[model samples]
Target: MSGTRATADLAARYRVAVEADDPRVLIPLYDPGALLDVHVPHWRFQVEGRRPIAEQVCVLPRPGRFTTFDGEATRDGLLVRFEWRQNGPTGDALVRQLHAWRLRDGRITEHLVFCAGVWDRELQQRMAVEAPLVRP
Candidate 1:
């Protein structure tokens, strides 16, 4: 497949993984040596290898609906911006994130995600104010 088509396939596969409620579906999307940079609120997990990454995703508590994913295929790779609202049995919350994935040989070689606290606090505060009003 062409690069654009491949990237689109990867994006579609990711959505399928979420919809299937099976993180194991993500396995084929990455290389054995793929690197994952996961940034969250209280901690950051910089993981390498398919098994470890798969394990982490498997253990993740089902965060609520991923409301939207807007993506573009770039010269370097693909950039996916996601808007999510988490409503588990325990709590409810919202988050906006950007993921940059570098693909090689049709698999994700490097994946970096920017989540809460990664950007300016003021910008986050502004987003917090505006996000609820804007429909996903």
Candidate 2:
């Protein structure tokens, strides 16, 4: 557990943990009674406890591997914004997410997430042609 928390970069920890597909790597990063509040579209759900949060995070059906992740540390905690996508013949599914985590005692006590929902290649193409973004 200490091994996982040795580094101060939380986003690096996440990249390692997710890439390794190891939930144990994140268990120590959260408080025993950690809270996770997730919001997607018009839906919201909550999960409590470190073990549950760790497990839940690992099982999330992200589009695929993360495309990008950026973390901004704040006085109380930090915010991580990232995207996931899988480009292949099957389809190119993309999902965007943001997480605001409050840390204390080197462990996260609260985590709030906002998900933009999933978009397949078709939808992505339509949106791109219909409404092009001036900025990425």
Best by TM-score: 2
Question: Could you tell me every candidate's TM-score relative to the true structure?
Answer: 0.76, 0.87
List, residue by residue over 1-136, the lDDT tens digit for candidate 1. Answer: 8889889999989866765567788888889999989888888879898766656543333566677887899887899987666566655555678889998888888888877533334555687787755553
RMSD of each: 4.7, 3.4
Pairs clashing in candidate 2? none
Q: How far off is residue 101 in model 2, in Å? A: 0.4
Model 2 C-alpha lDDT per residue in residues 35-69, reported as the tens digit of each score: 99999999999999888888777654543688788
Q: Which ten residues in a row have the lowest lDDT in candidate 2?
A: 1-10
Query: Whose lDDT is greatest here?
Result: 2
In model 1, which regions exceed 4 Å deviation?
Answer: 57-63, 117-136
User: Count of backbone clashes for each model?
Assistant: 0, 0
lDDT of 2: 0.80
